[model samples]
Target: TRMRPLMRGGAQERGRRAGTENVPGIAGFGAAALEARSNLEARTAHFLQLRSRLEDGLDEIENVKIIAREAPRAPHISSFIVKGVRAESLALNLDLKGFAVGTGSACASGALEPSHVLGAMGYSASEAKSALRVSFGVQNTEAEVDEFLAALREMTNRNGTLSGRSTSHFTL
Candidate 1:
């Protein structure tokens, strides 16, 4: 019987395994870390501003609650529950309208179960299942955030429960 290394290259692991050093990956990671460190304050302020805008807009919508509103959280991400709509339904509708959104933890991606994090926070199973996560990035602009808020407001208002099928009429 013969066994092959999972990753084959010139030499790796003191010649015990075969793989090449991930030079490019290491370099890219270092570069990203340097960039993030260089403008940490400015980036943080920008993210906070965007998140504030998103939260304010969300506050205007009925039946939507921002999770952990009083808790300190990362500035770039906002998690919320939009009652009467499943997270999957809203995420899929947003995707079809050219917007990318997340439902729960990436590890739980595509799982029909509710978010354990939200459940731990005392949210009901239905509330946890209705959670949506939106993250702001350095490349995102104020206009983009406004657009997303508008789209979300419209979808939630017009689609109601959106339990059966999505009828997203949002554009751009």
Candidate 2:
């Protein structure tokens, strides 16, 4: 239908994209990459540890589906599905409670049309719609993870499920 360069301006990016070279941004990115690469082992271990704690906490929640728990993936992302709740609503609630989370892939257009990632992995449409993508960072602490879990429990349990019904999140 229509096509244009991602960046338009000068002959930057080896004539692929357009736009003048962002020297400072490029330097920052390169520095960050170097730092991350230097700490790859520690970073992976830290994220995996955080992920384990999060998964353990989620395990006690009712009907929470841990997506691809045994599959190969980066240690930082923890994708899951909540039972009887829409992921978008859940993400909003979590945000209100001070946690930033992402919902469906098609949320760009203000629509929560379910995640293609989940669908490709054989999750049902409902499960896909209920998916949340939670990512951990090396700078995050165990206490932060605990705090988020507590907030999650408070949000999910306090307001019930996302089907506009009251649920006792305590036992969940």
Q: Least lDDT summed over 10 consecutive residues: which range in candidate 2?
A: 163-172
TM-score of each: 0.81, 0.73
State the C-alpha lDDT per candidate: 0.78, 0.73
Error of 1 at 159 (Å): 9.4
- Tell me the tens digit of each residue's lDDT in model 2 across 7-124: 6667765556777668999999999999979999998998899999999998877778788899898788887788778777777766766678776542332454666666787988
Error of 1 at 168 (Å): 6.7
Tens-place lDDT per residue, model 1, 1-172, is 7656776665666555767667999999999999989999998999989889988999998889899978998888888888878787788888876788888654455677887777788999898878888887888888988989877876776444653356531122
